[model samples]
Target: MTETELLLSLIDDKLRKCEDGYMLTHTHFLSLGERSSAMAHLKNRYPNHVFWGGYPDAERSVLFLLPEYMEKDDFSLEDEDDPLCLVRVRASSAKLTHRDYLGALLGLGLERSVIGDILVGEHGAEIIVMKSISDYLIANFEKAGSASLKITVDSIKNLEPPKIKTEFIRESVASLRLDNMLSAVFGVSRSDAVEAISRGMVFLNDTEATKPDARIAEGDKLVLRGRGKAYFREQSGTTRKGRLSVLFEKYI
Candidate 1:
């Protein structure tokens, strides 16, 4: 089955268990595709049920499948129970890159899903990991590359998200096709944009995109897997050359 189909089937099964007043959770952290697919399934199959998500102030989140009767108000969720943990990884007197942090974790046989966000800083980095694996990591994760590192358990509530650098971009495109907008925004040829989309290098709102001809609109977010992020704000007036002038925020 397709990934989306599999997620929909899983949600249906969970909703069945929810009818028995049991709250069910899937261990796998949902990616954008799975989350969106599951949510869409829930909306259609169980409209009044609760579909709550939490990563405790994290950029990405995991879902909690709840029934119609299981709603809440103002309760603070501790990161300790967030199914996640923070690892303060430090290399003495050395500033580690994002790669170094991820490399260390994966090298220790951790799956990508077990590792959440990796926030790099000046002296070290903080990474969010599955709580089930946190204790093991704290006890064993020692080095990143050839650098001797220290790993300590912390809480996600104490994490500070790194500020993303962004720049304003104003360009004119002949059309609102995704390829056209992406080409203008990233300074690539239209053919290059098409190629990128075909090769699964672009994402529309965090889901992998393959439609080069999809129409783009203002307020949409675009991400080139390894390139950067761009937010389409709105269109200004038409340019003297008869092209539509667009405004965007390009995150570096």
Candidate 2:
């Protein structure tokens, strides 16, 4: 088998529950093709259990759901116990990105024509299940490796939202000097921003403004094509002649 097929074989075997009447779920950050192949395996192996998948296009990751092992006393599920979990992962990529769990839920809400209560841990996204999804999480959580299982079944109870503070606010501008503005606002070296400015990455009001010392004023939109977008405001104060205090909102 190919490397991808081999990986799926391992995951399929590892995801099955030992007990009958148990459900299985799988979540991972595999590429699009890999996720499809895994789904196919689930279709063939376990047709009865609920199986779902999500591809966070912006974040470029996948999360799978298996809902067969939950402890539900009745059809009424508003009071289900411990339904969500968070697992911290050391992905192969060095850069870390966030997936907005609530954002995903909003989409599901639109699709189902119903709003559902989803409890997500502070660290990761939430998954909903009835009888089998819970079991799948447990089985996959173990097979996901100790390092991958950053969270456990118990942690999902009464989870709270994680807080993140805004570091900078973005604004629109007409034009700006490369070295003076970007260095102060973005906290980068003057030389580096200047270098990027010279390379024609910086723009003045949507047009590529190449001059590092370009005279920017209020109402001018400065867009750094690769980096982000910004707008310049009138000088509120001045630290130096070349360097003046200006208000700008930066795109994240």
Candidate 3:
């Protein structure tokens, strides 16, 4: 079965248990894409039940699917030392990048969803992982991109998010279609942008975006696979040529 199907079954079972006055949990962590799907599924199927989802310190989170009587604060995901663990990795030469650390982690046969946000900073990074494989990763995840680094198993209590790099961008597009937006902001050809989107190399707000002609609005986050992540800031005034004048931010 697909991952979404599995989550649907899990949610169905959990919803029944929640109605029976039991607060059940998922046995897996969720990636950004999976989290988006799961939330949409819950909003459609179990709209009334209360659900809380968050990673200990990372940006991407899990779903709690709480019952009506349970408050979000009453749940102590961290105080109970939740199923998440933080792995602090620092290379001495400062040559490590976000992909390097992630590549190393994945090389150890870890699924992407079991891992949360990977905060990359200068000289090092902190990886939020499911506790089930924390030891396996710490012992085996010792090198990244040809450099050996130190890995520490840590709690999620004191993780500071990485300082993301952003650049303001202004461009004019013929339309609000995703390909046009991507081409305008990144200076790619419209055909190339369409090809990228068709190849499943694009994500709109963390979910896989397959429609190249989908409209891109202000506040939308566009992630170009292997390229970069961009956020639509606003629609500025139109240009004299009748093109749409748009402003956005690209995370570098």
Candidate 4:
């Protein structure tokens, strides 16, 4: 079966389990594209479902299928009933990158689906993971790349993601077209921006956007696959050249 078909089948199974068993059921961590597809497939058919990671604004999340008796509000990362855990990894005298931590985890024979977001900090990293594997990781995980790691398991409620850093950009765009704004904020050629959109590499507010000329409003979030994410904070005013003066916050 195709990958998407497999994912849908798994989702269907979870839904059935929730309905038949009258309990909570969840899928593994899903990427942004997979989550979009899953939501489209579910639509409004299921009202008690929610997509969540350990924290807010998480890029990867799990889709939970709730039974009729359960309210969506009943579930929270802070609750001990959740299926997620926080794995804290502290390095000894060495800073570790996201890739280094991921490589080390995968080297331990764990599937990537079981892992959620990896928040790399100055001296260590905090990883969201399935509770089932938390004990195993704490027992087995030791080093990331060349740095020795001290691993500990904690409640998801204790997960403290690194503070986001952003680079403020104030530029004037000839138009509010996505391509024009992408070029201005990301510092790419107009042609490159258009190409990225056409190639399905650009997402507007977490959904894939293909139209280069699509209107981009203030407060829209733009994510370029290879590049970082940016937010259109606001349109200050028109520049002396009649272009739109826009402010953007690019995550650094």
Query: What is candidate 1's lDDT per residue for 32-136, written digit by digit as tens?
Result: 455546556666566544322333324345556655545534334555446666788777746678788888788898877677767777777788777799878
Ranking by lDDT: 4, 3, 1, 2
Candidate with maximal TM-score:
4
Model 2 accuracy (lDDT, Cα): 0.44
Error of 1 at 215 (Å): 1.8
TM-score of each: 0.82, 0.31, 0.79, 0.90
Residue 45 accuracy (lDDT) in model 1: 62
- The local distance difference test score of each candidate is 0.72, 0.44, 0.75, 0.88
Q: Compared with the true structure, what per-residue lDDT tens digits does model 4 show for residues 79-105?
A: 567889898888984567888999999
Model 3 C-alpha lDDT per residue in residues 162-208, reported as the tens digit of each score: 56679999988888999989888777899999998887677787667
Off by over 4 Å in 3: 11-21, 47-60, 71-76
For candidate 3, give the lDDT of residue 165: 75
Q: Give the per-residue Cα lDDT of candidate 2 at 5.
A: 74
Looking at model 2, residue 175 earns an lDDT score of: 35
Residue 58, model 1, lDDT:
41
Q: lDDT of candidate 4?
A: 0.88
Q: Rank the candidates by TM-score, best first.
A: 4, 1, 3, 2
